[model samples]
Target: MTGLAAASLAVSIAVAGAGVPAQAAETRRAPATATAQVFAVDWVSLGIAVAGYLFSGGGGGGGLQAAIAEIKAAIEQSKTEIIAQIDAIAAAEVEACLEAHTIEFLNIDFMDEYTLRAWAQNATSCATQASAFAGAVQSPQAVDKIGFVIGPIFAIVLAARAQAGFINGTDLVLQSQIRAYEAVVTKLTPTDCQLIVTSEGSAFYEKWWRCTAYNGDVGRSSPCFGRNCLPNRAMAETQATLNTSRPVANGALPRLRAALP
Candidate 1:
């Protein structure tokens, strides 16, 4: 009977100790569950932050690309507009110069028919003088005999007409060069235009002075001043102006091309 009682008492103590341990385990598990939930929330927050950062970076990059494209387009448009303006100016200048030169050439007076006939007759006289001198073998100088008989009349009419033609042609070509320079200046900025005008004007005046000086010599008589002198002079002047203006024109072409789109 005592053994039975003792066993019952021990069983009660064991039951009480098991209840305390079970309560302690419940308390630990509750804290562990709360800690796990907090960790999950922290992970979710970190993922959200990273996603937001990526979205923002992409948005910024796209905006930057769009802005750059707009700027480039604007620059291209500006270049095209500028180039067109310049070309129009060039065309007008060319036309004006051409008209001036054409008028000058057309208005030139030629030697009259009577004068031409008289000059022809002088050539015949020269032939006769040459034949007579050749036959004499005492050889009267052909030049001296011809000059004594016919050179003066030919010189007065033919030479005067020739000289007039030369001066007229030179003026025509110079006018053309002026027109070309004007056209180039038209494309430039007002400031650039002023520079071009000054440069071209200087070149024109220099060539004009030289041409006048050259033509002043009695020996330099021809429609183009004994050669292609006037045309050559005008060409030189045009080239000089081009040398100054071409870089600016060429630099603008790429921008103009880009702007077309």
Candidate 2:
């Protein structure tokens, strides 16, 4: 059977049927037979196959049927324990991967300083880091981080677009938008900066103008001078960057979770 088919069968047996019913008489036999078939066809193909049959269920007459049932029960318990261990290991692997990237995704050091130049420089660095992370998630080596069993299982179960695809695409858009912002920041006249700084108090200006300027939300009237006063191209670029950056950053973790088993 194919790896996916085998995983489907194994997952059903291990996850849903792992707890054999107390009243089960012939039920153990069915699952045991399914387990054997998983291995018999190509157990190692999925790298999740158990080593071998632990019980033969064979012997002479005289209470042999009762003895075989006991052995099957024991075997099922062992298989359940093994599957639990694998589940724990796989979960840890995925958690480690998520923890490693969480800080980077949430980093907004660009906004740390009030200066426009600081925003531009930090944004560039953030974009570069984001792009690199995007590649990391999509790389073939991702299997190493997500674990062998989880990677394929999630691929089958979670049909969401790969995490890297979404982030990388966002990075590309951000890169273009950042270049435009850089152009505007460099070209701002001293008069323009003076007018922006004096039009409002520092705290309010930081809160309002920064939102409009960084996010490129040209739809809202500029707090300092209204929509008609600010540089048009500059506002567009900031809006473009904010429009792309905010959603991607916000959704990164949720998307990662949804993509995993």
Give stretches of model 1 more than 4 Å off. 1-184, 187-235, 242-247, 250-261
Model 1 residue 252 distance off true place after TM-score fit, in angstroms:
4.2
**Candidate 2: worst-modelled 10 consecutive residues by lDDT:** 46-55
Which candidate has the highest lDDT of all? 2
Per-residue lDDT tens digits for candidate 2, residues 133-246, read: 333442322222222122122121111111111112322333332332222233221112212334354333321332232222332214444434443433333332232212
Candidate lDDT scores, in order, read: 0.25, 0.27
Question: At residue 202, what lDDT does model 2 achieve?
Answer: 33
List TM-scores for all candidates, in order.
Answer: 0.14, 0.17
Across 102-200, the per-residue lDDT of candidate 1 in tens digits comes to 222222235465654454344334333322332332211221122121111111222222323222222222222223222333322122111111123
Candidate 1 clashes: the total is: 1
